[model samples]
Target: MIFQPTYLDLLLSGDLKKRAADFQRRLKACDLCPRDCGVNRVEGEIGFCGVGNQVWVNSYGLHFGEEDPLRGWQGSGTIFFSGCNLSCLYCQNAEISQKVSGSEISVEVLANVMLELENRGAHNINLVSPTHVIAQIIKAIYIAAQRGLKLPIVYNTGGYDSIHTLKMLDGIIDIYMPDMKYSEPEISGRLSGVPDYPSVNQIAVKEMFRQVGNLVMSTQGIAERGLLVRHLVLPGGLAGSKTVLEFIAKEISRNTYLNIMDQYRPAYLAGRHSEINRRITSDEYQVVVKEALRLGLNRLDKC
Candidate 1:
């Protein structure tokens, strides 16, 4: 059976075009993410993300560093967006994410990039840090789908998305890959500059799971569709992994594809904060891994 991405239905019904226009219109008083900066991006007013109406791409290519199902034999088609909504102190890709460093490209060009990745035989269209530019992506998808973009769309985000935006993206995005950064407001506030991260992240995760439940894969171990959650273990257990695991087990689902990442390192402005200014210990990583196991999350990603 040939897999047809959901965007095909939306594109055929003309809903994709309408959604693109509606979302682009939202940039006039932009409320794309949870921050609700409300800056007129179309008219060049900047907000928390530091990006305007135009879509910016730092880089786009086939990335092999992703999880098993996503990477597969052919790498995941990754489009790394420039700006980010959350202000994480220890951002690994601060050069692009923090500074919003990227070339301004039109929707047509972005659409072309998707087609190019497809031509190169990418498994999925992985949009990393896509919380801000969903409107542009939708517009590009609208264009690309008509030209035969059949790969599943991956919404890779920092987990600070709004419920309204998620509702709009319900059918467009096939795989929802978001980070569950923290479960404590104080810790989140100190580390990520978003005090409501824990609250906002949980709501966004629920919406993601609602749209696409547990991950479904092909016989070749390629991810077809679903929700894949990523939790980065911060130094000294600051991420509140227990509460996060508990929430996933109790609220989301036991069958959820959990990726408990241990690749936290001091980068960008992390040196200023002594607490998280170093790499996490081996014991720290295992503690969260053990908690996830104890919570009955059996489908943990072997990352």
Candidate 2:
């Protein structure tokens, strides 16, 4: 066996306090995510993500709705944070995404949540919508390390990320789960209110793949370390699934683990937008899956 857990080993064997302090400094003038709002979140300035310095988690529990590998038997210790960087019109979790529902937590309380999940046999600590609150998450990781949190950390994001921000999570995060929303800029702009999301997401996914390559699963099928790309097939070619598959096969690694999702339905402002007003058709999803397989990406899940 290896000497200590990989991420926890790095933390315990090094001075995490220094890392935490350095990360906290970035919050002063937060360019933490790609949004680069340049607002001082530590000074209580809310930026594009509608969040401040403190991490606002909506829920902390075992989640089985994730991919089979991620969920496994027990479940992933999922901590869903409120306020998203990308305001997708069809955001399923509109309640938590648009409004802060949980109590404001300190690094200590956040650390406890990590341990609580570990005690309950969670495979990993999954941080959902973590782009804006990366600093606090790192600080919490440092604290949790001291208290013996050994499971791998998953950086679950909406794919609008800053490369500089991801650099800080170099040795901390083991799994990078990001959504590749749209392949066309106009579609992204119209749906998520973010222009040039296709190109922006490409850069971000490249950085994630650079950090972690293809998914390396344990004997039990739990992902140990890797980059997992999730793409939700939107209605009326908004997501451009064929192009996305081609990009993964050509630009990103062909062996990259992907989830070809088919669970898209009208939500949030989807009903307001004509292009995204309808649910994804079975044929549309089939075309995307066929393209993925043709591109040699065989690893996929319906959920």
Candidate 3:
């Protein structure tokens, strides 16, 4: 059977638009994320993410660099949102996430970008770094759905999301692909500047799994709806890979689709830190893979 996006139903019932307005209103205080910046984003007040009322998009296109399920035959329609809620010291896309390197666009333009990607044969609309600009994304998705956009919406977040915000996005988002960056609060605070990342990320992931049980796919092997987690293996067990996989197996689901990422090259301010300055060895990646299998996490993503 072919997959139908859930947001289209919300659009038809006009609930999507209402949710958009409700989300936009939160921008007044801007407690959208865990930071609770409290900045008046509706009145163009910039906060920790450095984004204001207008939506800034670094770029949008059909990208094949994502997971195989997301990319499919054509590609994952990726909209790289400019700005981030977390300040990771080793961010790979710091140019887009840290520094404002994209052009600002209105809701109409953002909607058009989604439609254009669908025209290009994209399997899904992947919103990257979406935690900070969720209100804007909801507005654009509503507009896109009204204009014949019918692809699954992927919330590609950094795992530092607020449960309240995720609650607002319950039916709108089809795919929840979040990164479980770290397992220790102190490590997260020192590396990513988020002191409560361990607790916050765990709660956020649990909520995401509750919304979409496990990663589901169509006959064509394209992702339909569900949760696809990413865990980057930090050197010297800094990411606590064993603990994370155990949580997935015990708390979440053994069928949870997980990607134990082996790509942890030191970037941005990583070189400043002695422990994370170097890249992970082949053995390090293999160790995490073994732990995942041992923990009964059989649905590991293919590298």
Best by lDDT: 1
lDDT of 2 by residue, 4-36 (tens): 346675676675667688889988888887778
Model 1 spans with C-alpha error above 4 angstroms: none
**Model 3, span 261-302: residue lDDT tens:** 998999999999999999999999998999889888888888
Model 2 misplaced stretches (Cα beyond 4 Å): 2-5, 13-15
User: What is the descending lDDT order?
Assistant: 1, 3, 2
Error of 3 at 170 (Å): 0.7
lDDT of 1 by residue, 1-303 (tens): 677788899988888889999999999999999899999999999999999988889999999999999999999999999999989999999998998787999999999999999999999999999999999999999999999899999999999999999999978999999999999999999988999999999999999999988899998989989999999999988999999999999999999999999899999999999999999999999989988898899899883
TM-score of each: 0.99, 0.96, 0.99
Q: Candidate 1 — worst ten consecutive residues by lDDT sum?
A: 1-10
Mark the regions of model 3 whose C-alpha exceeds 4 Å error after superposition: none
Candidate 3's displacement at residue 136, Å, is 0.4
Q: Note the residue pairs that clash in candidate 2.
A: none
lDDT (C-alpha, whole model) for all candidates:
0.93, 0.85, 0.92
The collision pairs in model 1 are none
Better candidate number, 2 or 3, judged by lDDT: 3
